[model samples]
Target: MLKMMTYFQGFSGHQSVPVTVDFPRSPPKLPSTSEAESETSMSEASSEDLVPPLEAGAALYREEEKAAKKKEKKKSKGLASVFSVFTKGKKKKGQPSSAEPEGAAGSRQGLDGPLPTVEELKAALERGRLEAARPLLALERELAAAAAGGASAEELVRRQSKVEALYELLRDQVLGVLRRPLEAAPERLRQALAVVAEQEREDRQAAAAAGPGTSALATTRPRRWLQLWRCGVAEAAEERMGGRPAEGAEVPESVFLHMGRTMKEDLEAVVERLKPLFPAEFGVVAAYAESYHQHFAAHVAATAQFELCERDTYMLLVWVQNLYPNDILNSPKLAGELQGVGLGSLLPPKQIRLLEATFLSNEAANVKELMTRALELEAQRWAQDMPPQRLDGHCHSELAIDIIQIISQAQVKAESITLDLGSQIRQVLLVELLAFLRSYQHDFNEFLERGKKLRSYRANVIANINNCLSFRTSMEQNWQVPQDTLSLLLGPLAELKSHGFSTLLQSLCEDLKPLFKRFSHTRWAVPMETLEKIIATVGVRLPEFSELQDCFREELVEAVHLHLVKEYIIQLSKRRLVLKTAEQQQQLAGHILANADAIQHFCTEHGSHATWLQPALPTLAEIIRLQDPSAIKIEVATYATSYPDFSKGHLSAILAIKGNLSNSDVKSIRSILDVSTGVQEPSRPLFSLIKVG
Candidate 1:
């Protein structure tokens, strides 16, 4: 029967079954059986009896078992309910739920409490109490859930109020998270969130102060606010880490942003604030701001390393520039500072040129001072192993000129300048001038050689010349002219004039001569025409010879003209007799023959015959005494016939054919003379000599 009951009850057959079973009634009951009796009785039951009894018992037991299982499941479910109730009761012990109606719950919570409208919600948010409105929010949620179809007006207000309250609550929570003591918050998140929040506040403030009437306020607030942020970040960072960030620690992005904003909005304010606190940091910030303004951040970044007191350095440089504008022009240090700050690379070429001019100008005064400063700086830099600044070749040239000028001007002012100073100054000036000359010499040569315009070259050369001349004159007047000055002043001018004239002549010979030759061959009388052109172009102006004009005298002029004529005639006569080859002799003879009449006319007009006869009368008389044909010389005979009273020695010397010529040649000369007056015809042969003589 137990087996049957077990089978009916859905138990595995291997397990022993109990002989009695109990069922639920209106009241509960307990089964009465000893533990061992129940076990033995379960074993004695026969299969048939057990089967049928077990079937009936199993059916009842099965139903009872199902009921008990259901009850146990219910008990397990009730444990969860008990735990939830217990937890709720515990939580409620500290805080109680209010007894407000569902529709009014959100409003009664004090945040969204029946303050009546959107305006109140905003007011509540402004007052910063949105977190306290949880009850009113719950009421609104209930109202929305209950009115699933559509909300009534009152329900809508409750819902809206709930929304407003929740919004305020969220905003407050976000702000609270941001405002949490930085130390109490997680570092990364706190800093990031704080930055965002602070930025938002600044933006709002800026907007508020942005209108025309409020621009000053807006402008000032951002700078103050940024400084506040920087300080806050520094303080927060310090508090969190037990000190300020380690030296060279990367400034937090928040701090950098704060600084940037401050600089952008209120540069002066930031500058003022930073001036005292962290000078280097201020310098860096100011430099960055300047670069930002000038749009040269990239250049600055590439060129400079960030440092502690760089901002002060930058400010000092800027202040110096403003204080002494001329200093920037004169002092390379001012420019170098700007370059160090990355202004050099950023400045345009034109601006760079302008800066160069400034440096040159500033250095114009007391050049020694400028040079000494430059040298000292250079030495210091070298000693420190620092890279050089942005000085160029032009700077050196300008500095050199300035020094020379200073020395020159000082020497000029001194009544009795020392020889040493004068020598040094003169040497310096010469070197500088030479450098200028060397640079332009090629240009001047080109002008002379190619016949090009030389205005520019001339201008430079003239200026230098005038300067040297003035210096020399000054020295002479002061009666302190040094040997060197005199040498430079006098020697160079002569050399220059000679060189200039030589160069001009050589150019004429090379370039103009060929042209002249071509035109002379091709055109009628082009030689004379070209000669005139040459004279017009290069002939020294006679009027400009002031010394000659000032000392002019009539006797002097007459004596010079007479000497010139005599020299010309003597030279012509010598040339006529010196023809070597027969062809040259014949050529000369032909020229003499062709112009004989003209020459005779010129001699007659000038009374050259009368002058010649007067000097040779004695020589003619002596020659006339020797009437030898083979041994009586024909020259002696001709002289005797032409000037009977002249000496033989004089006649022989004047004829100049003392030995080689034959009698026929000497007689040919005599045939051209005018015998009646002992005078030779001016146009006739002045001499007759064979080629050998």
Candidate 2:
């Protein structure tokens, strides 16, 4: 029959100095980085080496036990001395034990239980005697000698000899709790390392002071040993605690709290212990520190003990970077892990806003200087333009681009200070950029106000509005920072548009109002050529006003058309006194036809762009065409029938768009039309609407 084989995992005992390898027996090759390979090579030939593998020591102890058992079988009287302490499970003061806790048998090895208490096994581990289980192991083997005994005794022996989840859980669960105590609770693993690390620390002190003529290398040997011990401890302590915790196991709320006070203190203790071993071989220290983040940080997160927030993730990355600043690139695993912790994840915009704001709070003076520079650059350009008081599109356009480029989206020094700055450090520059945007909005607005007059209203205002919107669009694309972060800087440009839209329109109205009124109401009755002048001035101003057109909407542009045309029709209708002589009336007839055609062309062209202006079209068309009294009744009847609800007052107002229409003409036209005015009062139509009595 084949035997079931159990192979012990390889373990190397202590060496006061690092081991070197020579592959002369095999093919010549570059030396391996493996500690085990070097340790094995050193043990094979080095006569000065003292330590042995744990399994070897346990095997040697088993041989001694077998001899004792043989001696006990020859003289049965010695059984009391052997079995007395074993069965009694006596514990010395402060001496570690392997006794099981009461009712904790379920936690013992396999289905059956160990003879000693499990709590005692934990106590031995806490004391850092890596070989603490030897006594219990010996007793279990001695009691379970099945070759010399029967099936019942063998069953009893197997129950007592079985290994439990103790060592696996010690590495997986208990050790992790010590490292991240904020999100974990058990303290045994930390206490265990503290005991072992303290012993290693004392061993170094004695080794260093042993000889006066010790070489520098010899004196540092124990320190190097301590450093390696730290690596080993961190490795064992941070064994993967992945998957779900056993049912009913607690997973802490790490998201709600930002601080890791207990864990931080443990980290500091680790750093202090590892710090002394360095001036010699500090990469070991750095390797161990980064392992804290790589292994433990993930363990806690995977367990739902703590979430890796952006700030915490950034800090951990930086802390690990500092651990190996001079050689971080060489440690690719650490660098890769640091970069992956949260590097590529997109943060929510609101969180980014908070982060950016926090980052920029300290750079107030620099931010102000950038804003000043942007405004001064614009102010200088404005001075060189044709209309000095006129708003220059180029200047404001450059201003928006310059302000966003120089201040709100400055190139942050991310690479140079990788160790000094954390991930949240990105937020610092971002916040300042956003602050610059907010503070200088008023500055942009004031610059806008300074050049209120539009020299070429169509080309310049659109250029200005397009430039502002374009600047924002370009910043969003070109800025090296996150798109979400850069978008916050665009808020101020919208403010400029909101308030600046009204300002630009008001200035245009002030310039053109008198011209519009003269053309509409002049009693001298200007010629067809004069109507061209009105078409050129007001023609250029209406419809595609660049500022409004850039943010164009049907309802809004149509409303502008209505407002301009409403004034035109009302004032033009009031100019009835111009005609008296037959020669003058004939001359006025030509002028009125031209004015009506020009007005009709105006409404038709603009109404095309803003389709809502279409309903007002016919009203302006009829108003401008009304020249003779015979045509008046027909035009009035057409309007009343088109809008059957239009009242006599409304009919009179509609008839008043012609300057020649008088009270007698309007009264006779309405009477002929018989506008019922049944119930609906006269309300002006939207597109061709004119403010009238």
Question: Best-fitting candidate, measured by lDDT?
Answer: 2
Error of 1 at 384 (Å): 57
Give the per-residue lDDT of model 2 (tens digit) for 210-257: 654412111212323334444544443344222223465442423211
CA lDDT scores, all candidates in order? 0.33, 0.42
Question: What is the clash count of model 1?
Answer: 28
Q: When superposed on Cα atoms, how far off is each prediction in RMSD? A: 34.9, 19.8
Residue-by-residue lDDT tens digits, candidate 1, 260-291:
22222233322333233332422433443343
Q: Which prediction has the highest TM-score against the true structure?
A: 2
Stretches of model 2 off by over 4 angstroms after superposition: 1-373, 380-396, 403-463, 471-527, 536-567, 573-608, 614-617, 620-693
Candidate 2 yields a Cα-based lDDT of 0.42
TM-score of each: 0.20, 0.36
Alpha-carbon shift of residue 555 in model 2 (angstroms): 13
